[model samples]
Target: MGEKLLMKGNEVIAEAAIRAGCRHYFGYPITPQTELMHYMAKKMPKVGGVFLQAESEVSAINMVYGAASTGKRVLTSSSSPGISLKQEGISYASGAQLPAVIVNIMRGGPGLGGIQPSQSDYFQATKGGGHGDYHMIVLAPSSVQELYELTVDAFNLADKYRILTMILGDGILGQMMEVVNFRDEEKIETYDKSWAANGHKNEREHNTITSIHIDPAVLEQWNIGYQKKYQLITESEQRYELYNCDDAEIILVAYGSVARICKGAIKEAAAQGIKLGLIRPITLWPFPVKGIEKIIDIPKAFLTVEMSSGQMLEDVRLAVDGRKPVYFTGRMGGMIPTVKNIMDKVMEIKERHS
Candidate 1:
């Protein structure tokens, strides 16, 4: 621990990326998450880093792809609609196997719906946001502190696997202020980027980086390699936090800030002699199936709470796989589900099961 500072989640993300050795940032302005770009603009030049405010989200992500190809740590961020625009470039990055960190501070959306917090992009982030048999490591941070910690982890994971990593947050976590402890002497890990297209001088062969494959057979092999990498990541990187799950009767499933709210619900339910537990998934893509598996025979049912219309409910259903009944309660278009809302659903499930 070096120093503690009171900062908003967006600012923490910007600072953490800097500390994690990121030197290139490319992004456009968008609501709720604009502060992250603003912070980068103010800090990057001072640290001898590159921060370019591109003309559009599409331009920014392509810039990121260019920077990443050079074996440099790079980052980009946007909200829902802006992230949508970057999907093509993200897909391109995935195809090329370039490493970069992308941040999505979610707001209500199907089409520029509103500038309020939302987890509606759960499916978009966890499932392939871009396209073509690919997945980015998706991390859902529940607080300003985690926004700092996970932003660093995002860059590390991206480099470690030579793939894209996504920090999936929402407007609340982006705007909310909290005290964050910065690591002064944390060792930033490095990887072999000999595969990067950063020029080999006259010593070795010049490295070439590209995502284009004209032949179907070559593309099929590329897809197979990507799936194998994804499987390895799935086996090694599933992360989650379980609260009071050992003796839980009704387990609550959630991620990001929604999971924070579920904790409150759990406490309230406990006071009323109801045993409620929560499973907070830190990595949305891997989905923490192992964590759920450990207590599969314990909990009678599951209640998945979200700020979207049951987007993550699909994953929970697959994880449970009919061994236990799963239920859902959510609010869309930026309405957050309150603790009372969660408890109400919990009580309803208890009644049905009883």
Candidate 2:
């Protein structure tokens, strides 16, 4: 264990990134997540790391690509629209197989959406937001402490898989404050960065990092390799928590802030003699299919709680696969569904099934 400190979500996430040995940060200012950059700006230089504010999100992500090309732990962040601008660079990084971490503090969006927190980016994050036959290992943190722990995990996973990793937070989680315990974990893992473009100095074969393969056959082989890597990750990396699910008649499927609220709703439902539970995904890309599969007694119904228009509900639907009923309730444009709102939704599900 490490010392506990009171901190904001964004602040703790930045601190954890440093502990993960990330020495390069490139990002633009966006509300709800700007504080993360501010913290990095103040601390990176103090710790001999580099903190650079790029002219734009596109430039920022490309800078991440450059840093990672040297086999350095690198990171960047942005909100929804900014992340959209970064898609091309993210795809480039994927094509080049560069290991980097990206933080997306989501806000409502299709274009320049509202500054309010939202989970509407669920599809974009879980699916390939950028063009490519690739995926990022996406981690979602519901608490400030998770922001710390998972940010550390994100770095490790990115390096291990030699792929992009993302920490998906929302405006609520980014701006909220909580107690965080930072432990200096003794890392025993090693990554082979033989593909890095670090100068060979004529000591070995020239190493080049690129995604451009003109030969269709070569590109097809590369895609196949990526698919193998993804399969291994999916089998090993699905993470979720099942709270009081053994005999649950109804369960709430959520992640990030929405999951936090569902925890309370579970307690409320229990008091009303409703067997309610929660399945909170810590990794959105892998999507915890196995955890969803192991659900005992098959809860009568599952409700997806989100800050978007039922985006994650689609995954919940897919995982349930007609064995159980799946329902959804959400808020958008910065509105958050209250605990009462969530509890009410649970009651409605119970009543319908009753």
Candidate 3:
């Protein structure tokens, strides 16, 4: 425990990364996430950390790939379009098995969309934005407090699996302010980086880090090993929260800031005897299928809410596996789904089913 402080969401993520022993940051400025970079720029040098505002997102992600090769905790952040520019480097880092943290403060997008909040990048963050058959451990935070805590978790998970971890938040979460208790007294656990590219100093054989494998057999073998690692992560890392699901007729599936709105809708539905429950996914990559599996029989149907045109709906359907009907309601172009919208959709589903 430590003193609680009111902090902006983006700034707190930066501070939390610092507290978690992140010594390097490489990023380019972009809206809704520029404050995060600013905070890192201001505090990183003061704390003996390195912060570089790279020439571009592409350059920044490659720099992260380089720094992460040395086994130091490295981070980078960008909004939707900027993140798009970093895809190749992100793929490179994944190919090299580098442990790095990347944050996407999502904004409305399909190409230069508004700077307001949006979850349209759900597929990009969870389903491999970069080219390749790989996945990043994606953590979605619903509040400023969660923003602080999950940033630390992102770093730990990245190092634990030697894979990239993404803090997937929206513009609203990035700009909000709330009280957060910084875990200053908590000691961070360290992992062995025996595979790092740091010099051996003649005590051992020199280490090399590269993703290039020209031989098809070698690449196939490497991919097989990577798939095994991913399966392990998928089994161990599915995180979710169930609310009022013990006895409910409908289950609302959501993540990030949208989950907060779903909670409110649940309360209101309960008051009206509608019996709405919620499944809030904390880790979008693992998809929390187990959580859905546990309560699939309890709820008559599942309704997915998002800031995009049913991107997460596909995953929910696959998880439910036609055991129950799945429905979707979303608002795009910076429009947020309100409690009323959710309640209305619930009523429609109930009526049609009844």
Candidate 4:
């Protein structure tokens, strides 16, 4: 057990990763997530770890790929534009079945849009950002505590699945200060490097790490095998938090910082005699689709709120499968919607239904 201490989400992420036994971090500084890089730079060396600020996001991600190939727990952090640059490397990591952690403190973007918070990358992340028939395990953190916990979980899940794992956050979640209990140093397990590409010594054969396959059938088989792993993860690793749904007539679907704001609105709506509940998705890729579907049969409409132009709403619609109406409320370009605004929307939905 550990005592809770106040810490910024970005700093907590870096600290937690180190405590979780990650020894190598390669990242290029980007806004909103810069605190994460600074924290790593100052602390990694003290713990006999490596922290390198690469030339660009491209270089940083490739550096991470190299470290991950050696079966070393490695990490990278960036905002939207920088993350876009790392997409190619992220795809390679997935295809090569290398376990690594990448944190995207999402910012408004189609291309270099803004430095503020946004959930526009939901599709990019959940659907495989780079070109390929591949998927990364995407974890969404809605609080500073979750940021700390998910960073540790991201590393563990990546290694367990032999794939890249991403902690999807936003500017507010990255910058906010909250109480978090840091895990003990001894509680973390050291990774086994039997599969890692640490130079082939005597009695060991050369281990090559790559995604390139010349044979079509062989590549197809590899893709099929990876999909099976994804299916297993989807079944066993879905994460979400449900709030006050026992007698609810309406449900709010949100994630990251947006989900936290939705929680307040949900509470207020309940006070006003509007039966509202919240479904906050913690793991975005292995999305809590099945869990959400189970609640859809209760005869309630869903409001998908986000910091983007309805990116997550599509997922909600898919999960609901048209059993009920799914509405969308969003604000783009870094605007944070107020609790009153969300409550007002909930009221509108309630009035319409009534």
Per-residue accuracy of model 4 over 247-309 as CA lDDT, tens digit each: 788888999999888888877877787778888998888889977976886646999999998
Candidate 2 yields a Cα-based lDDT of 0.89
Clashing pairs in 2: none
Count clashing pairs, candidate 2: 0
CA lDDT of every candidate = 0.93, 0.89, 0.93, 0.88
Question: After best superposition, candidate 1 residue 314: deviation in angstroms?
Answer: 0.5
Candidate 4 has a TM-score of 0.97
Runs off by more than 4 Å, candidate 3: none
Lowest lDDT 10-mer window, candidate 3? 181-190
The best candidate by lDDT is 1
Tens-place lDDT digits, model 1, residues 1-354: 499999999999999999999989999999999999999999999999999999999999999989999999999999999999999999999999999999999999899899999999988888998878899999999999999889999998999999999999999999999999888865689999999887788889988888888999999999999999999999999999999998899999999999999999999999999999989999998789998898898889999999999999999999999999999999989999999999889888999988
Per-prediction TM-score:
0.99, 0.97, 0.99, 0.97
Query: Which stretch of 10 consecutive residues in model 2 shows the poorest summed lDDT?
Result: 181-190
lDDT of 3 by residue, 1-354 (tens): 687999899998999999889989999999989999999999999999999989999999999999999999999999999999999988888889999999999999899998999999999988898888888999999999999889998998999999999999999999999999876564676888999988898888889888889999999999998899999999999999999998889999999999999999998998898898899999999899999989999988899999999999999999999999999998998999999999989999999889
Q: Give model 3 RMSD, 1 decimal.
A: 0.9
How displaced is residue 113 in candidate 2, in Å? Answer: 1.4
